[model samples]
Target: MKVAIVGAGLTGSLLACFLARRGLTVTLYERRPDPRVAQVERGRSINLAISERGLNALRKIGLVDEVMADALPMKGRMIHPVTGALDFQAYSASGDRAINSISRGALNNALLTAAVAADGVSVEFEHRLVELDSAVGRMVFATPAGKVSVEADVVLGADGAGSAVREQLLAEGIVAENVDFLDYGYKELSIPAVDGEFALDPGALHIWPRGTSMMIALPNPDKSFTCTLFWPAGSFDALTSASGIEDHFRINYPDLLPLAPNLVDDYLNNPVGVLGTVHTLPWQAHGRTALLGDAAHAIVPFYGQGANCAFEDVVELDRCLDDTGGSWARALPLFEARRRENTEAIAEMALANFVEMRDKVASPVFRLQKQIEHTLERLLPGTYVSRYELVSFSTTPYAEVQHRVHRQHQLLGAAAVAAAGVLFAVTRSRARR
Candidate 1:
C-alpha cells in the first residue's frame, strides 16, 4: 500500500516509521524544509515531558533507549512561591517514578531519522498539502518546484492544529472542526546554565504559580532550563519596555529575575503563542484519509501529554491496521472510533490542569489534599491512584482514568460526610451523658 503522511512532524515521522516497518511504501510530505538541513523553529515548546505512554510507543519501534538517553527525569513539581518558600510535590506515592524532559527538536530528529532509515520510507520536504479528495485517495501538494498531484491508498493528516488536510475535509463536509482559543497565551524564555551547572534543581519541573498567570521550567540536556510563561492575552503587551519587563518580573517573580539574565531580551523578542483546544468530529474521511495527534485534537499544555498523546495515536493506528489485516478501509474508521473518546477525555483534563498548575498547586488546602492523596495511595496500593499517576505512570486508557478519578473523588467525599456525622453524634451523646 502506498501511504502519504502530511506534516512530517513528530507524529507524522513516527507514523511513517511504523507503516514502513510493516512493509508499506510510506512517503512523508512536509511543508517546512527538512529539519535535518534547516534551522529549528523558535515558537514551539523547546522541551516536552514524555511519560510512560510516549515511552511505550518509542519502545515499540526500538527507539526508546536512543531517544531517552539524554532526557532529564522530573520526579515532581517544584513549587516556588513568592514568599521565598519552596514546596515539593512528588508525582508518585513511591517517590521514585518520574517523567522524562526531552528536547522537542532532538526527539523529532530521532523519529525522522528512524523513518528515513526504514526500508520503504521516503520524505519529500517543501511539499505542502493544498487539496485532498478522500473519495479517490488523491492529494495535491504545493511544492517549491511546482504543484504536484499524487494518488495514495491511504492518507494521514498529522499536519497539526492548523491542518490543511483537515480544512479540505471540512470543505468536503466530511467532518466538523471546532477550535476554542484561550484568553491566555504563552511565551518561551531561557534560564541558561550558570557557570557550567544548572541554575535550579534538574530533577524537578519548577513552577511559579501566581494565581492568574504561571511560569514553568523544564530542564534541558545542556543543563539549562526552558521556561514558559503563561499569561493573560494582553499581559505581554503591557510589558513594553526593558524597565517594564524587569519591574514586572521583579514584582511577580522576584527570584526568577536574577536566574534568567536574558529575560528582558526574550520578553521583548519572543512571540506570544496562543493557547486553545481543537475539537473535530468524524476524524476519518471515506475511511481512506484520517487525522491524528494535534490535527484531530489539540489541547493546552498544562498536563504535558500533547506529544505523548500524539505518539500513542501512531501506536493505536498501527494496532488497528493489524486487527484489520492491513486494510485501510477498516483501520481508519477503527482508529477514529477508538481514539476520539480518549482524546476528548485528555483534552478536558489538560484544560483543568491549567487551573491547577496556575493557582491551586500553590494553595495550602490543595497541598494538604495532595499529601492526603499520596498517603492514601501508599496505604491502599493499587486501590488508590492519583490522577497524575494514572495519566503519567500507566498506559491506562485516558477516558477510563478520568472516569475512575471522578468516581474516586465521589467515594472520598461520601466517606468524609460519614465521618463528620459520626463525630457529631458522639459529641451530642457525650454532652447529654
Candidate 2:
C-alpha cells in the first residue's frame, strides 16, 4: 500500500520508518524545510523524555544506540523548593533505571534520516497539507513551486496538535474534535553550561515547584539545560523590564538565578506556548485515513509521555496492520479501537501529574507516599508497581496501568489503616496491664 504521512516531526518520521520496514511505500510530507539544511527555529524546542516505550520504537528501527549517544540519563527529579532546599526523588524503586533526556530536534532529525534511508520511504520538504479527502485518500499540498496533489492507499496524520489534516477532516465532518485548554501556558528559558560543565546535576530533571507556577529544566547534550516555565497565561506581562523579570525569578525561583545567566533575555524574547488537551473521537476516517500522536490526542506534558505515547501509537498501528493482513480498511478501525482507551488514560494521568508536579511534589505527605510506593515496589516486585513505573518503565497498556494503580492505592490505604488500628490496640492493652 502507498501511505502518506503528514508532519515530519517525531511521530511522523518514526511512523514513516515503521511503515517502510513493512515493505509499504511511504511518503513523509513535512511543512518545514529539511532540518539537515535549515536553521532550527529558536526557543521552540522542549526537550523530550524518552522512556522505555520510546526507546523500544527506536530500537525497532535500529537507531536506539545512535539516539542514546546524544542523550543524557535522568535518573530522577531534583526538586528545588522556594526555601532553597533540594530533594531528590528517584523515578524507580531500583534506582538504576532512568529516562533519557534527548533534544527534540535531535531525535526528529535522527528519525527523518532513518526514514529517508529506508528502502520504500521518501521525504518531501516544505509540502504543507492544504487539503485532504480522507474518503478517497487524496491529498493536496501547497509547495514552494505550486500546488501538488497526490493519491494514496492510506493517509496518516501525525502533523501535531494543530494538524491541518485533522482540521480538514473536521471541516468535512469526518470526525468530531473537543479541545480543553489549560489556563496555564509555558515559556522557554536556558541555563547554559558554566565553565564547560553542567551547572546543575546532569543526572536529574530539575524542578522548581511553586503553588501555581512551576519551572522544569532538562539536560541537553551540549552540557546546557533547557528550562521551561509553566505559568498563568497572562503572567509574562508582569515581567516587563529586566528588573521585574529578575525580581520574579528571585521571588519564585531564587536558587536558579545564578544558574540561568540568560534568564532575562530568554524570558523577554521567547513566546509563551499554550497548553491544551485535544480529544478527537474515532481517529480513523473512511477506512483509508487515520490520525496518530498529537494530531489525534494532544495532552499536557506533565507526565512526560507526549512523545513516548506518540511512539507507542506508531508501534500499535504497525501491530494493527499485521493483525488485519496489511488491509487499511480493517486496520484503521482496529487501531483506533485498541488505542483510544489507552490514550485517554494517559491524557487523564498527564493532567493529574501536572498537579502533582506543581503542588504535591513539595508536600511532605506526597514525599512520604512516594517513598512508600517505592518501598512497596522493592518488596513486592512485579506484584506492586508505582504508577510512574507502569507508565514509563513497562509496556503495560495505559488503561490497565491506570486501573491497576487505582486498585493498588486503595489496597495500600486499607492496609495502612489496619496496621495503625492494630498498633493502637496493642498500646491500649499495654496501658491496661
lDDT of 2 at 163: 92
Best by TM-score: 1
**Leading candidate by lDDT:** 1
Off by over 4 Å in 2: none
Deviation of model 2 at 201, angstroms: 0.4
Displacement of residue 224 (Cα, Å) in model 2 is 0.5
Residue 94 local lDDT, model 1: 88
The stretch of ten residues in a row with the least summed lDDT in candidate 1 is 36-45
Candidate 2, residue 158: lDDT: 95
Q: How does model 1 score by TM-score?
A: 0.98
- Evaluate model 2: give its lDDT: 0.92
Q: Considering only N, C-alpha and C atoms within 3 Å, which residue pairs clash in candidate 1?
A: none
